[model samples]
Target: MAEKELLRISNLVASFSINGGYYAAVDGVSLQINENEVFAIVGESGCGKSALALSILNLHNKANTKIEGSIYFKGRDILSLGLEELNKIRGRDIGMIFQDPLTALNPLMIIGAQIEESLFYHTGMNIGERKKRSLELLTQVGIQSPELTYHQFPHELSGGMRQRAMIAIALSCKPSLVIADEPTTALDVTIQAQILDLLRRLQKEMKSGIILITHDLGVVAEMADRVAVMYAGQIVETADVNEIFSNPLHPYTKSLFASMPDAYRNARKDQRLPVIEGMVPSLLNMERRGCRFAPRIPWISDAAHEAVPQYHEVKPGHLVLCSCYKNFYLKSIPRRVSSSTLR
Candidate 1:
């Protein structure tokens, strides 16, 4: 049976004003997350991944940012909510694990106080209850000596511990939908794995839907149930995790896989890992129509691309944007290359 839908975003466009004109950073994006599901948004640095996440919570500066379209969480339109109404949902119903804990957490606030802050606003627990809950959360997130860590400020904790504390605060309210934006960014590999494992175990325990925003395909492979590949401020491909790994359709998606170090093996010692040519277009300079990925893969003929691209589901439950994917092939790798060959 299909899992219950937890959140839905439709035709969402998040644009920023620069020099009197608004340029879209997340354009015409739509997707849903189900209860207990991990929906990953993967892309390069400037592909609007974080912009989309911030839009969900209406966290951008309204004076300079323009957000259109509906963000429905449990059937209520988040865009339609006022500041007070939205505040009620922010920590209690929808938690966010920000990319950088050092910047996200309060420098002067003790670790325990930060976690208690969410509970204080969302729950009616008193000081004693709040402290107990805070310590429990810190311990839950794998921080040893929760009692001692509780009194320490953000600067005193190690990077991994700070990140764990961030997790504790996000999960303090046991929110129904958690948006973890680059939750493991800047952490060492060992700590990154531990954080990922903690998130997985906690999600299973809470049965909360997760929107994992990251560029790491490895993290997506390990944690996501469904994956969306974004490029040039739009989602170019989406599919089941297994399907995305087994059959990546979009040129951008294929290029991402090809760029991974593990994708190449038994190669000539001199052969370099393939790099996706060109950069993600700047927001103001982005092509508003046609195949957005065309400029990057110049070898593919324009005839293969749709003049006005739309999602084409080449397989059940797998959608690839633009018809160009049909004709896409790496100049280095031959056509009909199997997943094994790439891996």
Candidate 2:
């Protein structure tokens, strides 16, 4: 069975002006999310994951930030739409779960008012109805004492409670697609599990497509239906969640798996935990040739890297960037790993 396509992005480039010159934060990226599925974008800290999420809704400052390319949601090119038109869809059709609840939520505003703002703006709900819906939303997101929570300010809540409040606000209008940018970031292990489980349950209940952005492969393994691995500003690999865990093709992807903690490791044990050598290259003044991950993979021959790396689909629904996979080895060791040995 095939899932319905909810959102599609193509050649999307989001650039910020620095020293009167523009640098691509998200460069030539393309991906899609489908209904009733969780599609995750995983990468290191500086890999433009959040930029890609924000670019989908044109959420950048017009003064310094420029976005180009098409974002098609529900068969419409939302990128070309005006602010008035986009506003109608922003909270009504699509919801965004920001990374930091403290910063995202207003300090002066009460929780119920924040949730009701979307309803007030997008729906034709009266004041009485809005308050009732807001209380129900708080309860649905696992918050105890809905009435008390509604009147409380963001400062009065714990980190986990604040996150649940953010979730409540996001799902207030039952959006068709939800973009959760590191929804569980800063919470304890127990709270993280609870939040992820809550998200999964709400997604199923609302039947919404989810684009979960995070650096946690463990979370991806537990929640994602498909995953796209980003390096620098480009997608280095993408595949079904099981395919990624079972047989990681891209060297960057393999390195990420190798560096996982014991709890996230998949039977690949060793005396020392693996770490990918070298740091991620600066996004500014990027190398205009070869693989973006080539600097960190000096052991692999230059011949294995393409001048302009492109995704090559070697299997059904599996795409790997460039030929760097051929000569990929760990921790400065030079070994040609054949696809047969990949198993």
Candidate 3:
């Protein structure tokens, strides 16, 4: 049987006006997240991953930007909702934990008060009940001494603690869907692992779907059931996490894995970490036709630049945007080549 989709985004096009012309930051991106699944969006900087997230929540000011396509949540089209409808959904139905905890939290507000505020606005709970629930949420997220941490301001709490508080706030209303955008980016490795574990636990307990946006493949590998790799404002590849790691088909996907710090370090003794050759092209110059990555493909001919390749299934349930390049590149070239061999 087919799994039910909790969220479905199709042909999403978003743009920002810069200088004198418009730039498409998210171009015709489409994907779906099933209930009780962790879907990840991975890409380098300026790949429209963040833009896609913002579009789903209707966070971008519509007056200044143009957006098209559908974002359906729970059978309703979110893009078609009015301000009041969206307000009712945001935080209550779909919660978000942004990248920076300090900035996301109010410095003057107590952590407990911050979480309670959501209840105050969204629920009819009195102050005492709100506080009790807030503490429970804080404890649920693994904060030690919830009472003590509750009284602390954002500054008094450590980075990881603040992040936990942020998570507690997002989960205050028991939202059905959570969008965590690089929630662990600023934390240490140990804290990152803890936060990921907390999210997994919460997802399982609440049966909520998650959209996890991050550039870290390691995080995706650990947390995501399904993965979408974005480049130049488009999804270049998407598959199950195991399929992505074992058989990444897009050149950009392959390059991203090759550029990982661990992979690069292991591949060479003293060279700088492997890097994709070209900078992401300016969105202002983005073309509606053709693959946006063709310019950066190492040796592909100009003909490859003429059109965007239709997404192809290399295997059951594993979809890639470009032609299969692993056989052409991986098998033809030795895994380890000496400098003399290149010459």
lDDT of 1 by residue, 1-343 (tens): 6789999999999999999999999999999889999999999999999999999999999999999989999999989999999999999999999999999999988988999999999999999999999989988998879999999999998889999999999999999999999999879989999999999999999999999999888899899999999998899999999999999989999989878876434664756667777788999899898999999889999999999998998887799999999888886644445788775
RMSD of each: 5.1, 5.7, 3.7
Lowest summed lDDT across 10 adjacent residues in model 1 is found at 262-271
Clash count, one per candidate? 0, 0, 1
lDDT of 2 at 152: 96
Q: Write candidate 2's Cα lDDT for 79-172 as tens digits.
A: 9999999999998898999989999999999999999999999999999999999999998999989999999999999999999999998899
RMSD of 1: 5.1
Residue 264 of model 3 has an lDDT of 34
Q: Is candidate 1 or candidate 3 better by TM-score?
A: 1
Off by over 4 Å in 2: 264-270, 332-343
lDDT per residue for candidate 3 within 138-196, as digits (tens), equals: 99999889999999999999999999999999999999899999999999999999999
Q: Output candidate 3 Cα RMSD.
A: 3.7
Clashing pairs in 1: none
Query: Which should have the higher TM-score, number 1 or number 2?
Result: 1
TM-score list, all predictions: 0.95, 0.94, 0.91
